[model samples]
Target chain A: MTNAPIFERMALIGIGLIGSSLAQAARQRGLVKEIAISTRSEATLRRAEELGLGDSYSVDAAVAVEGADLVILCVPVGANEAIAKWIAPALKKGAILTDAGSTKGSVVAQVAPHVPEGVHFIPGHPIAGTEQSGPDAGFPTLFDQRWCILTPPENTDPDALEKLKAFWQGCGSDVDLMDPKHHDLVLAIVSHLPHVIAYNIVGTADDLEAVTKSEVIKYSASGFRDFTRLAASDPIMWRDVCLNNKDAILEMLARFSEDLSALQRAIRWGDGDKLFEMFTRTRSIRRSIIEAGQETDAPDFGRHSGD
Target chain B: MTNAPIFERMALIGIGLIGSSLAQAARQRGLVKEIAISTRSEATLRRAEELGLGDSYSVDAAVAVEGADLVILCVPVGANEAIAKWIAPALKKGAILTDAGSTKGSVVAQVAPHVPEGVHFIPGHPIAGTEQSGPDAGFPTLFDQRWCILTPPENTDPDALEKLKAFWQGCGSDVDLMDPKHHDLVLAIVSHLPHVIAYNIVGTADDLEAVTKSEVIKYSASGFRDFTRLAASDPIMWRDVCLNNKDAILEMLARFSEDLSALQRAIRWGDGDKLFEMFTRTRSIRRSIIEAGQETDAPDFGRHSGD
Candidate 1:
């Protein structure tokens, strides 16, 4: 199941978590002959060089994309448009241009217009990450057993799309094809809404006048610790997600709020049957997620295994 | 660091996750000389016996409590009253009667009146568990490095409290004491609200018309899977928590909803700065939780370690 080099030269536009992981995965799996990495941050570019993440590293994204047959925009979703406009002229003819943004519709809306006529613009989201960020936070196995959803534009070259899919598979990811708008909607519920709720709940706990923060920290293992992992994610990235996918996120938020109000009502009225029914039904989703191999079956995510 | 048998005979009134874990923990640590187990369900009692979780098993709470020096009510918070009344006469003189329920105030309210003379009734909550339940879910290490908070009445004998604390320490948990009401409030934020929010979000995802359940399941690794762990907790226990700790849970839910509304408005208005600031501040709490040893520092709760 090993892959030959799918692209002679692959350019990475940001050397953050996703970028660094992609570089390592591609190199380890021989997915690309050469990798040229660029980030706007001088320290990050320097760190990428120090880590030997690619064959070439540069602060100027335009220089890195020169002659690169495959270019991936790995910065936050909000940073895609400027990078797209900056590198469009330097893109190789017949090159496949893609992104690893969390929101495909937003990435498409931002970067599609700037893509060169001959470039293949396919937006994608790898549904994998940790709370940590930066080049230092990535490992080659980050995408192992994870789903990477690609939203290739209409009229996209089938060969180019297939090549991109193979590239992701080479990096140890299961590739899924989805429409850009539908991808946004799905991510809005699965990712964006969860992050927003986690942030909101953590904020609520922090603002509590009645309960001390020390108490919250000391007893978090009961449940709050789980949400904190999502809450502790990169702020700038999540803020961008909130801004870029506003419509779908807000719709999911509305539904969540409506559901919370109903749960609140059940508690206030002591409707044990209603509360039990709601809690009972939600358990099946976790089982389904585990059966899908998207989640570990180990208890507490096996966080306590070290004990 | 180790304990001799603290109690000659210990009675467990439920054989679910917490009860079975307690039986194993106490037996493995030599905290009790003999263990007696009971539950309303005859099948569960038979399963408990087959698992060798205790020296004696009974469906009769009274029969299990006879001659036991310590008795723990480990049923759902809502079931405490009837169990208390049934076991009150059988409880040995000077026995320490405690509970492993999540909500302290509710346990105290439900079980205190049924306490017989000379029986020390302390409401305790061990902030440890997985999404799994039943006798087979029990493990000796379940409570290791976790917190067990005991809320003893003001007039209670100090020796009984100390002995109960020692028993939990034998089970490998640190002990903290708080007023029952304060314990309820603290738990409402750290445990109850988180579970409530998780259940609400999972239910909302289930009821979505636009997104298919298969889609949510396939892509849950992004964030939705974290909440699913809490949402998959025992329904009866959570139902009782809502019914019993109504006021504190309601207050926390109100705060969570209010903060969520503000987050929604920020998303609607596209206020990236506000979202960033809120998201940034919450990161510190998670750091504190990790530093305080309340959470695993490993990213994604080390769920991806297997990959």
Candidate 2:
């Protein structure tokens, strides 16, 4: 058993779903000796304190970062620069700083300039979350068996990168290292595009005057209910995701739209073969995801939970 | 107690997910006196027999429907025409014939020509399903609290319609009667378009070269897995749904694409207000679905068993 404490004092600059989850996971596994929590609002900070999420809680980022060996900014991507500037003076000289933002390139660009000389600034994204938000909506198992991608600036301390990797591994995630730009591109295709599509489709269903709102709700179990969950995610967080990752999202959207047009044409022409071929190809991916243990094999939302 | 037997003998032609669920529901509730099961393959018929799903099993639809008081065709939409022709000669006099097909307009056109003079041909769709298929992928509660929409042709007998409505009610679903064209339009936006969108997005994620296939699977809990469940549904069934409901699906697809493009433009121009406004409005529809008992209010895929 490795008894190395990843951090003596860890500062979590935002105590929302991701931040609280990280704090819980670290606390449960004894990965940190003490954890300090901070957020913009006193209400959320008080809630985090009430939940016993950290050893100390404060509304000031600088106060939270004092004497911390590792500092993680778990705020929205758009808030990185301000938080980084606010906490820069109090950050320990040799401490490693990272983020759990969805978009990496923008986060790095916003935070790198504010970092002090000796602090290692590495931006990371733990590609895991629930549709819920806030301090109360977190659990230690949230990151279990999930992927945590780290994007370190070139020529930064290799020792700091490995330490961060060890920390994430202790929290029960597989660590992956990639260039910030590549990470942004990949997430834009896999994560951001899907969310944008889901929001748009739900909006489309809501605007339909012919289909009574009651009818849509009644029959949503067929397929539309799945999209509703994603569409119901935090609007501000998603808006930041879209605005920060514009180029890759736009590129993926263009490709998706082109493919959709082909599908529409096939439907219009009654080309059953084309539609069948496309639908058939998509099924194999789901199987692969299941086989990889990324999803439950239970049929229909695992309705047979007791049996 | 009202103990009127809905039908002396009911022939269910196609013992798959929906068909078998109806068999179980009917058997458990004593809705039908006898059920004659028929499918294209002998193996599925044997499985259905082993599961005690019906009283008798047959590979021939004609043999299965002989002397039956009511016939419910539960095959894929693409097979409706062929099954209709096969069972036309054996349907009993004054029997009510209906289908549980997902698409209404196409099934009506395909099955109407083969209906005998004394038979009442009504088309219905039970808007409920799980991602599983085959005989074992069914349960007694599949139809409970679901909407069962029926589309009867003009000049159809009232007694026949009333009997069918009573039969569905006994199986635990409230029945709605509407025109076939209108049913097609309502389902196009609610069901067909959502499934197609899910399949397309899953396909897009699978095709991404930047994101390793494993990464997509590892991080799927971040909204992508929800789409995978819908995409994993029976490919043949969805293909037929797209082909059978062509015009309405095409119109919905067009509207969805237009809305998606406008959202894409908003993101490109950094219009956070537009994105936030749209995302916020879509959340209420999800709330309405929960209020209507179509979905659970449990957050994050209902990870918590009780909310």
Q: Tens digits of per-residue lDDT for model 2 on B18-114?
A: 9999999888888899999999899999999999999999999999999998899998899999999988999999999999999999998999999
Alpha-carbon runs more than 4 Å astray in model 1: none
lDDT of 2 at B147: 93
Error of 2 at B217 (Å): 2.4
Alpha carbon lDDT at A136, candidate 1: 92
TM-scores of the models, in the order given? 0.99, 0.96
Which prediction has the highest lDDT against the true structure? 1
Ten-residue segment with the worst summed lDDT in candidate 1 chain A? A298-307
TM-score (chain B) of candidate 1: 0.98
* Position B259, candidate 1: lDDT: 82
lDDT of 1 by residue, A1-307 (tens): 3567899999999988999999999999999999999999899889989999999988889999999999999998889888999999999999999989998888887888888888888888899899999999888999988999999877889999999999998888999999988999999999999999999899999999888999999999999989999999999899999999999998898888888888889899999999999999998899999999989898889876766
What is the lDDT for B85 in model 1? Answer: 87
| Tens digits of per-residue lDDT for model 1, B1-307 | 3567899999999999999999999988899999999999999999999999999988899999999989998999989999998999888999999999988887877789989999999889999999999999889989988999999999989999989999999999999999999999999999999999999999999999989999999999999999999999999999999998899999888788888888889999998889989999999999999999888888888876777
Give the Cα error of residue B232 in candidate 1, in Å.
Answer: 0.7
* lDDT of residue B111 for candidate 1: 89
